[model samples]
Target: MNYDVFNGDADGIIALLQWRFADPLETQLVTGVKRDIKLVEQVEVQAGDELAIFDVSMEKNMSALEQALAQGAHVFYADHHRSGTIPSHGNLDAHIDLDANTCTALIVDKLLKGRFHTWAITAAYGDNLIAKADELADKAGLDAGQKAQLKELGTLINYNGYGSKVDDLHFHPADLYQALKQYVSPFDAIADNASPYYQLQSAYQQDMNAAQAVPAVHESSKLKLFVLPNNAASRRISGVYGNWLANQNPDSAHAVLTENADGTYTVSLRAPLSNKQGAVAVCGQFSMGGGREAAAGINALSKDDLAAFIDAVETYYA
Candidate 1:
């Protein structure tokens, strides 16, 4: 059996899409909500089975990966997230780049020699590497109109991946991958009005409208915080809303907190786009939290710690 396990975000989905589009395969797909990184353990691979993994952190899935390799499954892994020491095994091929400006899709693009270059650019945009994506788009000779299209498509696909669970998403990541795989190029999907691009765009607009109406619960020169009500919509929109906030106020750090049912908060933190640093360190101070330097998150933060989190962010950015 062949299994493709990937993170259910724009980068993961599109990275796999580029690969499968290059080499069509019969495989079992394993994915989950954006936060579910332990996908490799879910696949029951036997000797001789093939495994392809993308976009998820190797540190989080190391045990499962070791298990798959020990079970004689040949594995190909690619990602840009934090990876502890990588294992050296005859049956495993791991491609990892921790560069702040790179993502898994871009790694795949490099491997494919840009056969699906446009999709890689879209993934970059979705991952919130705005300046990086713009540079690639310009180098590719894409006009302003074309670049805008790719940016919007990338943003929408990314927006679909933020939910706490699949139930809150517009389309399961697997289904989104399948839908997008039908088009050889992302522009093809945009050209067709009947594509997931349009559906996601509409849904994203509705959620953004609701999110924007809620004013900041706290604001200061160094940090601004918004607390959203507990609901599926809040869970679905908080991450993207954080991205939006970071872009809107590039000089100040921002936090988007969605009230969880357990009275905790699912937190999304973004360092000022002007200085994309310290967010990971700030979030790392909390349990169930850690991420890249530019953006990080806390899966569930105690209500009591909310003030402390804000203070930490402010102090770091100050």
Candidate 2:
């Protein structure tokens, strides 16, 4: 058996696609939302099985992975996350590069040496490394219009991974992967498979427009909190909405919280461009971890901690 675990986002899916294209193999997939880093532990591996892991941090799931390795499974890991320490094992092969600008899609691109450069460019755009994507797009001889389409597709795919659950996504990552499997490149997908691509893009724009209509619940000189209803639509739009708010209000740190089915809150944090420093620090106090200096997310937070979280942000800004 071959098992492939990846993050449920454009970069992860593209990475998986590149691997599959390079070496056509039947593999079971394990994935979740963008922030779900512990996907490797969700599967049970048996002896002689092969596991290919991508886009998830080894540091976060090292123990479970080590257990699988010890059980005699051969593991191949590729990620750009912060890897703490790799276990010394003969059966394990890890390709981890932690450069902030590097994503799993680029890793696969390097490994495959541009076998699927177009897909790699889409993943880079999804990761918000637009300059890198643009460079690759130029090398691939894509025009501005084509590059914009790829970037939008990448952004839409990335946005689809924002919500707390599968219900909130425009399309489940697995289903999206199936849709991509039929097309050779993202450009080809847009050109040939117009229905799925345009359908998702249309839905994404609708969600963004809806999110723009919601008024901010609280705003001060330095911080703003945008509270969204616990609807599937709101959840789908949360991250992109938060990003829009951050860019629109560059002086105010933005936190977008959507009520979840369990009554807890799913939070998306965006540090204002002016500061770009407090979100991780504040969310860290609440035990949520993320990076990118300008953006991050917390999977869940109790309603009880809302006050403290607000206070922390206020204090940080003060």
Candidate 3:
């Protein structure tokens, strides 16, 4: 048996597509929304089975993966998440890189030497690594309109992965991947599958509109903070809101915090365009892991820590 485990997002889907396209094989896919990082435990791999894991970090699910490897299964993992010490195992082939500029799609592209460069670019755009995506797009000879279409598709696909639960999404990331597989590129998919693409675009617009309507909680000269209620739409809107706020106020840091079902909060932190660093440190105080100097995310923070977290953010900048 061969199991394909990936994060249910554009980068993961495109990475899996490249791997499968490179070596056409029959494999059971394991995936979930962006928040569902423990997807490897869902599968039951027997001895002699092979596993391909992408996007999801090996460190976070090291125990389950170690057990699978111990049972004689060979695992190939690629990811960009912050990983702790990687264990040495004969059957494990890990390609873990935590560089903010690198994603699973780009990793696969590097491995394959741009065999599927366009798809890698789309995944990069979807992951909000715009400068990197544009560089690849320029190298691939994509014109302005083509780049825009690919970016829209990438953003839509990325947005679909934002919700806290499956029901909150416009389409499940796996289903979106299945749909995408039919077309060779994002523009092809948008042209061939007009209905689904339009539907997703419309839903994205609605979510963005709702996000824009939310009043800012605090608007200082240097920072703007917004708190959203615990709702499906809020989960989907939080990231978009943070990005929008950062763009609207280029000189100020933005924090968009969404309340979760358990009375905790999921936080998206973005530094000003002028200073894109320390968000990971801010989230670290609340026990979250993310990348780069510009942006980071915390999965959940207890209600008790909310006040302290805000104060820390204030002091960090002060």
Q: Which candidate number has the best lDDT?
A: 1
| Clashing residue pairs for model 3 | 276-293, 276-294, 277-293
lDDT of 3: 0.80
Evaluate all candidate structures by whole-model CA lDDT and list the values in order. Answer: 0.91, 0.82, 0.80
Clash count per candidate? 0, 0, 3
Query: Worst ten-residue run, lDDT, model 3?
Result: 286-295
Give TM-scores for every candidate, taking all chains together and pairing residue i with residue i: 0.97, 0.87, 0.91
lDDT ranking of the models: 1, 2, 3
Q: Over the stretch 166-225, how does candidate 1's per-residue lDDT look in tens digits?
A: 999999999999999999999999999889999999889989999999999999999989
Cα lDDT tens digits for candidate 2, 1-318: 999898888889889999998898878888887778898889887899899998887988898899999899999999886677999999999998876556899998899999998889999888766667889899889999999999988888878877667877867787887778878778778887564678878888888887778888878987889878888788777876776676687788899998888887888888775776667667767756554445666667889988888888888878
Model 2, residue 115: what's the lDDT?
A: 90
Q: Could you tell me which 10 consecutive residues in candidate 2 have the lowest summed lDDT?
A: 287-296
Best by TM-score: 1
For 57-107, candidate 3 gives per-residue lDDT tens digits of 776788889899889999998888766788799998988877766788999
Error of 1 at 55 (Å): 0.6
